[model samples]
Target: MPLHRIPVTADLIRGALDLETTPDGGLVPHRLPPRARARNTDPQLAAVEVQPSGVRLAFRTRATEVELEVRPTTRVYAAAPPRPPALYDLLVDGTLTAQSAATGGDTLTVDMTTGATELTPGPPGTVRFTGLPARLKDVEIWLPYAQKTELRALRTDAPVEPAAASGRKRWLHHGSSISHGTDAASPTAVWPAVAASLGGVDLLNLGFGGSAMLDPFTARAIRDTPADLITLKVGINIVNADAMRMRAFGPAVHGFLDTIRDGHPDTPILLISPIHCPIHETTPGPGALDLPAFAAGTLRFLATGDPGEAAKGRLTLVTIREALERIVTQRAAEGDKLAYLNGLDLYGPDDKDLPLPDDLHPDTATHRRMGERFAERVWGRDGSLEGF
Candidate 1:
């Protein structure tokens, strides 16, 4: 069939933290804004922050069939286990209708042991969805959460237009990789996305995979972005990065909140502590990738810091949660519309049966559970964010 080709331009995409034009007439989704991008020089951050965690392309169409040409950069870990194939999700009128995966694109191979990287180029692959209703309705193509994608083109049987404004509450969220959709089935299945769907909110997910440090640039970006509600899922990234001590963490949290408040003085802000991470619960981090497990084709994480270090002010999930609760309490006393929620409330002790496969990121089922819990606890009628 001769299909009508629509260029994949920035106007067609939404939920992206940032959009970058590719030299080859394509668009790449980035989870970090340009200003924040310049401040973080880590190559790892550069790669993962562009993984399209909650990013999706939205349009209105009456077409019964749709297709997209994508140029993806798939990562390959040398001396480590192979990763799963990336997937693209199709949603029609807010309902997940179909999913597709391309065969090839670019391959980035990394030798974790040697700290070396190599890129092997590949061509774009096509993804198609057929048998739609034909009535004009909202359509969304959610890119892979674990792969960096360069969208080349879109095709539909009928004309496509931008989706109408949902007029939903804007919920701006910032967190680590887990919130960035690690191990999620698709971009739309990310915990935050799930929560947003259940809570009836528009999500601006700033969940940078490994770059959710309390950077001033990030704070400024959040402050500038208009939002009805805001949430910061902190601690895990700081601990995993070994970025700060207890003293520094408290002040940094305060500063991050203060920056956001500069623009959204009364916007409801929720501070979420780290979820249950056995390794980092008592043991301090810097966590390391478990090479042995990785070599065996399974990704695993191990906290390397001494448990005794907690007494010395080194941060652990437990210690960080305590600190966060205290800070939020003190701030709330000052009349700030801020609240604290322990991450475990979303994923915790009772979830032992649903183990996090990598011992770091939650599994698909866990993501769904967390999302449902979050929506009920924060956005529900009598929830913490009730008035906001």
Candidate 2:
């Protein structure tokens, strides 16, 4: 069969927070918009935003085979174990049909001890899928949210056209690595995607790994975006980074909300506190990787700050929950379409045994549970997100 090359452009992509154009006529999906990204200097933020967790290329085709040429930047840590290769999910008419991965992409090596990083560029990799349904249907190619992918070209046995926009509400969600799909089985299996699917909404995930701190630029991005629904899964990144004190946190939350409200005056906004992270639940953070666990072939995190720091106004998950509840209550009283959902309700004491394997981000199963719960509580009949 003759291959038909389709230009890979933003018009064919969805769920990207932003798209960065490349010099080679390619496009890199970014989870953070450029205006919002220019203000942050953190390399971690820069890297993760470009991972494209919930982004996908959608088109209509009748091809039995599809192929995408991608240039991925695989992250590597000098002392850490080798990271897994990124996966691409192929969906036909909204159902997962196949999955594939590419090889021979760029490698970004980070030296933890010296805090230096280097990038060794490599050749583009091709992700191909065969045996797909040979009838005209909507096809979606979901990029890895955990890897940086630059789209070089797309080809199919049949010609393709962009999928029409759906009528579902646009859900703009901001959170940390878990929402960025750090350990999700695939881009679509991420909690936010699952929840969006169950909730009947279109997803625009802004879950920047390690960078969900209440930055003004992020708020501005949220404010400027056109979203019918918005959710801020706050606290974990702030507490883990030890980025703010309690006294500063409340005001920061208010400022973030105020900025978002500037553009979305009455959008249904949900504030979600951190989920059940035992290490940071009561103990204040600065969380660090458990080096011993790392050496033992398991990845784990441990709180590094003194538990007593809470007395000094240091923030913890517990404190953050309380603060978020209070803030939401006050804002709601002012007639804002705002609501609060305790993270514990999503993942609580009863879920202790579930595989949060890393002791931080939820595993695939936990993500499903969270997504289901979120759908029931926020989008179900008579749920908090019922109207608007």
**Per-prediction tally of clashes:** 0, 1
lDDT values of the candidates? 0.87, 0.88
What TM-score would you give candidate 1 relative to the actual structure?
0.96
- TM-scores for every predicted model: 0.96, 0.96
lDDT for position 357 in model 2? 78
Kindly report which residue stretches of model 1 are placed more than 4 angstroms away from their true locations once superposed: 381-384
The sequence of per-residue lDDT tens digits that candidate 1 reaches over residues 164-231 is 78888899999999998888877778999999888878888888787788989889989988898999
TM-score top scorer: 2
Reference-based lDDT, residue 90, model 2: 91
Clashing pairs in 1: none
Model 2 Cα shift for residue 340 (angstroms): 0.2
lDDT of 2: 0.88
